[model samples]
Target: MSFHFEYPRTIAARRPGEFKPAAPKFHVRWQAPVTTIVSDYIAVQRQASDMAAERAFFQRMRRAFDSAYGPDSFEEMRQTDEAGMVNSIVVAYWTDIVRYALWKHVDSFNAWFRSTEREQEAVGYWRETLTVPYDRMETIFSEPYYHAGLARTRQAALEPMYTAGYFGAMRDRLPISAIDPLNSPYGETTPEGNYAGGPVRRVRVDVPPNVVSIRSGQVWQKAEGEQLDDYYQNLQPKLETGMAYLKEHPETTGYLSLRAIVHLDKDGQELRETSKHGYFLALAQLERWAAEHKSHLDIFKHALAMRRKYGADRQVVTWHEVFVLGTTPSLEYINCHPGTGLLRFANVWGNPPPSN
Candidate 1:
């Protein structure tokens, strides 16, 4: 019913005749002031030639992964179906200091990783990390940025570019934050706090591949407390109101892809509610909405606090994304807490969850 492989003998026993390349040292160069790293990790258990084969492979693969990584229905990591396969990709950013550390010691890290027991257990899974460097040009800002309580593995080293001269400006212009080398989509560990660091740059993506055909999907959370009843009731009204707003503004044209409703909670209390609309040419419109109807944002936050007070539960919202085979644009949302509502935006859409 299942298959496993023994650790490769050649990797285990390195003969003296083997030529082990010396580990390369990282070099610190004053190149780009900003760097972004995107990481994609995938697990493949079985393969098939066609749809029938694909489905069968998926079933077997799920079973295999479940057996290997799950028991008593416990999950270490979670996955979602993408365009064609299940995948997880995370984008993070780093300052020059962290980049220097990675570049100098990557070879040594890779060597140890390949020699690890986990490497021995990997059957068909493969992981790849990609880094991109960008140059920051111009920025239009509304507020100062801040990041707090980041996970240990995901903390970024913020290296101020003293040489880049981003410190000051004369009285004629608005204050702007620009990275000397602005790297988008950098892969860093997730911060433990609710907010992402920085003033938050919003990006508009071209189109989404995953949620194109999907019109709706089910959302669930462990049902508990009075919060459960009130949360969903509040969400139902918000969804209707939000969708009505989008439908009224359907004629607009920028990054129209999907609508995502994020229902987040604190403990058993359902506290946060965010509705993201994948717009088409609505970048300017989104900013306008936030500016004009700031009061609505207050109502939403109050809803969250009310949910928290009653030991409420998970709130759910159904969504859709626009996708086209040739050229469909996309958008992403990064919601700020009580202070700013859905303040920052990114280009990523329909990214799969990470496996534990």
Candidate 2:
């Protein structure tokens, strides 16, 4: 079924001609290497008491980005939950990965992370960074004007290619048959020549008739050898069940779409990572899903229990940030790619090119 969004109209009305129609065409885009995505999870223990400081901290971060890379170099979005958790994500496209690496070591950049105030505050801070080469990535824009995610870099118009069904969209990107088990570009290889990397997982479920929702995330083990082996063996089954449940009951969940990807290192490795990253289309759905589903709760309780058992020093730190739709200037939309997150609901918020 076709999903409809109410805000695009409101957004358009507010901005007047900003959302006006553009040319009707399909396109393929490539992000220059080494493209990087940085996500920061900032949580205040006392929400009411620390709200002001949290906001100020975020503002300071914005200023830092502006001063270091110019306003247009990056895009940022913030999401806050009822439980007082806050997640801010910044996505920047770099023409050169070496430059991006150098900037991180700059005095001011290093100082921001080392700030004594941040360290002493009750707030917790964690960051994940991922850098990927251009050829290792793929992007599709359903219309000529829409641009978001990796599409933020370069785009070229292409002929329209429709999918046969829900899975077809994913197949268009990388056919299941062509997916290289040994040397997938999606992740890095281990010393043993095994693909021991974290790659984004995409799930698609039918909304009925003419629409579908796509959800994507990353899966990785926190520790090496036995610990990592046990983590995936246990987590994979639960993830499958969760995806099935979500597709089976979408209405009660408000689960339009979701994406949870862990940022990888510059070499595309995620070995023994301490933190993870994710973005949700709707925070309410996540809350509802977690509260109502035992599996979801089990995952949470298990993680907490494991941490307690192992102690903080040995346990993995997990955190996520949610983005407010359209708030990120860098998240510009030109068109909707079929069966992609949020893009599936483009019927509501998307601006389709003018019909010939």
Q: Best candidate, lDDT-wise?
A: 2
Model 1 per-residue lDDT at 135 = 19
Name the runs in model 2 displaced over 4 angstroms. 1-51, 67-72, 81-84, 115-117, 154-168, 171-179, 182-356
Q: Tell me the TM-score of each prediction against the true structure.
A: 0.30, 0.39
Error of 2 at 36 (Å): 7.3
lDDT of 2 by residue, 1-356 (tens): 21111111211111223332232223333322233332222222234445565456556655655544322244444334323444333445444544555555652744665454544555544332333332222333323343334434433223333321121222223221133221212122111111111221211121121111221322243455654665667654565566556645656544444333233333323333222223233334544576668767666566545545554333233322222222211121111123333334334433334333
Q: lDDT of each model, Cα atoms only?
A: 0.27, 0.36
The local lDDT score (0 to 100) that residue 12 gets in candidate 1 is 23
Error of 2 at 185 (Å): 15
| Model 1: lowest-lDDT 10 consecutive positions | 165-174
Cα error, candidate 2, residue 311 (Å): 55
Highest TM-score model number: 2
How many angstroms is residue 140 displaced in model 2 relative to the true structure, after the best TM-score fit? 3.7
